[model samples]
Structures are given as structure tokens and as C-alpha cells.
Target: MFVSKLFGGRASDTFITRNSGLISHLIPGDQVLADRGFTITDVLPPGVTLAIPAFTRGCKELPEHEVTRTRRLANVRIHVERAIRRLKGFKILSNIIPGRIQHVDDIVTICAGLCNLQPQLIREEIEGKASDLDEDEHIDEQQEGDEYSWDMAEDIEGNHLF
Candidate 1:
């Protein structure tokens, strides 16, 4: 799943996603779960869906269904974040990659492979139960008022910048 090259730290998420070659590997009916920062709907192939949290632009609060979807998405993202944390456990990845390194991608791929070979992060029983949890059940223990920043850039049309 490592489809993109090692990009600089300043690269935008959408820009990296566009050049990642990840879309080519996906087929129709596939859904790409992403963070709100990635506004890649325009570049997605036909029949592919992008799932991100709903934006509460003009509303005081998100609708019930949107809240449910956002919670579920956040629950799923926890595992993804854990996997990334495991990948970062490697000493080489913990530090900033030197600019002179020409084969950084290969090294990262090898490290990822090594991480994959380790024990599964989530046990099957727990994973199954996690999926079965009710939509209203709060998985994340984040405090109230501690929300992600909504100060995102927008295009001339008032749409979120990609």
C-alpha cells in the first residue's frame, strides 16, 4: 500500500494523495476513508467513494446521522493511527530523514514490511466487538470543546481547498 514516493514535509495531503497511485489499485465500489484535510473527491476514479467527516459549516451542530458516521470513522481511524505509530517505532523513521538519502522509499518499505511481520495490533475478538459497538457509543475519550481546528483554506467558490 506504499504507493507514493517519500515526499517533503511541506507537501500537501491532497497533492501527495493525487500522486500516490493509490487510486489505480482501487476498483469500483471501493471507499477511501480519509481525514477531513484531504479534499480529493475531484480526483477519485468513477464509482469510488470518499468518506470523511461532515463539515458543520453553517449549522450549530452536526445532524444525528452525520455524528454517527463521524464517530464510526473516528473509531476506524484509531487502528490506522496505531499502525502508523508502530511504523514510526523504527529508529530510522523516528528522526527526520536526511535529504541526502536517495533510497528513502525503499528503506521505508522495508521498515513497513518489518512492522507488518510483527503481531497484529488489535486482537480479532476485540476488533469484532469494536465494529459491533452502537453508533451512539463514544469510542474516543476526547474531551468536549477539544475539537479539530476548522480554519481550513477554501477556493474562490467557497469549497474547501484540496
Candidate 2:
């Protein structure tokens, strides 16, 4: 779901508080694909999964498994980034809508709606790449016992050493 409400540059972790209403709508086991900036896992509805890239802290490189997972995530996430780009394409949002502008919120919402109606931002070429990665994911799932995908809080699960 696309959110067009203006949140004036608060930390991404504050997303839970900002979008509290959204939480009630989420069902258990829902998969939320987000970037590393979203660190509000604690506030997520129970059983809701948050998928983000693996962090490479202290280590020179991420594990081979992590690298593959990250690649798969990036393949899906590019579309989200492109959609944001489309929203920002509107001049009002690309530049600052002045405080004096009447109904600025409505204008922003309208722009977002219009942007959504436009064709998918990413071209068809990458669609095949995403599908190919999906097939690889099935193969990986069969090979790896339980490590199906990248989860931001995997470390907190107390299974991974690094």
C-alpha cells in the first residue's frame, strides 16, 4: 500500500508510531519488504515479517548465504525505489511545496494517485530477472534447512554468530 502522508524527516525507526493505524490492518505472517532504514521490528504486529538486507558490520564481507539473500532482496526492492522516484517526479514533491500553498496535503495525495496510475517505473527487462531470482529462491530453500530468506532480526534469534 502506498502512503502519501507527509512525515517531515523523522527517523525511519519512528515509522511504527507514524503509521500506527496500518498495524491493525496487517495479518499474521504478512511479509513487509523494507530497507535497512526501517528498524521498528519490535512494534510490528505479531508474526509479521520484515525483510531487509543483511548488515556487514565489523566483518569484511557478508557470508555467502547472506550475499545471495541480499541479491534476491535487491531484485524485488528496486521496484519500490522506482515507485518512490515516480512520486518525486511531480514538481511539487520534488521541490518543496510552500507553506502558503492551499490544500498541500491533498495536492500531495493527488500527485501520488496520479503517479500510481502511470505505467510501472521499471522496464520489463528486470521483471525476468526478478522471476529468475524467485526460481533460485525455491532451489535455495530446498538446499538450506530453514534459512529461507533474509530477516533483519535474524541475529537476535540467537542462531547466527555473525
Candidate 3:
């Protein structure tokens, strides 16, 4: 899914142009979920569906319905974000890659391949204590004047006590 290499200064929308060959794999029935910066819906393949969050255009808050929709979109979008985060975990992609670096493409590809061989960035099912809020429960108990509580512990909101 990695697309073409372009200058870092160029807008991502610029890469969606017909000459960029980035959308060659897209077909009429394809569905594209993209961020707001990708405003190239008109250039998409015919019948393609593009899902993006609503824009506020300077308004302080989006409508409640738009907010809900945006939250849902963000939930799905998190997976893509996590994938990119994992890719960036590799030292090569974590930093600015110089254009003159030797075999830079190969390095990226190898890092991505290595990442794929590892466990998934996220799992569908929750398991054991990882899924439980045991620490929060312990904190709640400690808040009830327990002997184990410190004399000057701050609350979760950072409210300090003398």
C-alpha cells in the first residue's frame, strides 16, 4: 500500500494527481478512507466512495451528529494511525530520511516486512488483567483514607494536598 516517493515539501494531494500513478490500483467500486487533507475526491475513480470527517471551517465545535460521526471515523482511523506508528518504530523511518541515502526504499521495505512478521499492533479480543481496570480499583480503595495511602499524594487531576 506504500505509494510513490515524492518530495517531502509536496502536498499529499499533489501526489494523487493522474501523473503520480498513486491511484492506479483504485477501481470504480473502491472505498477510500482518508483524512481531511486529502481533498481529491473529484479525482477519485468513478463510483468510488470517500469517507472523511466534516470540516468546521473556523467554527468552535462541530455539530453533535458530526461529532459522533467524526468519533466513529476516528475509531476506525486509529488502526491506520497505529500501523504508521509501528512503522515509525523502526529507526530508519523514525527519523528524517535523507533523499541521498543509499537503498532507502529497500530499508523501508525491509522494516515494514519485519514489522509484519511481528504480533499485530492491535488485537480484536481483550484478555486477562490487560482488559481489567485493576489499577483504577486499587486507586479508589487508596482514596478512602487507607493506611497505605501517602500523606501528600496528588489526585488524578493533579490536585496537590499538603
> Largest TM-score belongs to which candidate?
1
The lowest-lDDT stretch of 10 consecutive residues in candidate 3 is: 153-162
lDDT ranking of the models: 1, 2, 3
User: 1 or 3: which has the higher TM-score?
Assistant: 1
Output the lDDT of residue 27, model 3: 58
What residue pairs are clashing in model 2? none
| Candidate 3 global CA lDDT score | 0.49
> Which window of 10 residues has the lowest lDDT sum in candidate 2?
153-162
Once fitted onto the true fold, the runs of candidate 2 whose alpha carbons sit more than 4 angstroms away are 10-20, 95-102, 122-162
Q: Order the numbered candidates by TM-score, best leading.
A: 1, 2, 3
Against the true structure, candidate 1 reaches a TM-score of 0.73
In the order shown, what is each candidate's alpha-carbon RMSD?
A: 9.6, 10.4, 14.3
Q: What's the TM-score of every candidate structure?
A: 0.73, 0.64, 0.58
List candidate 3 segments past 4 Å from native.
Answer: 1-3, 11-13, 16-20, 57-64, 94-100, 125-162
Candidate with best lDDT: 1
Q: Compute the lDDT of residue 33 as modeled in candidate 1.
A: 74
Question: What is the per-residue lDDT of model 1 for residues 1-162, given as tens digits with 9 covering 90 to 100?
Answer: 243678888988888888878767665655677767778889887877777778898899999977876776676556565556667778886664678388778778887787666665544443443436665664453322232111221211222221
- The lDDT per prediction is 0.60, 0.53, 0.49
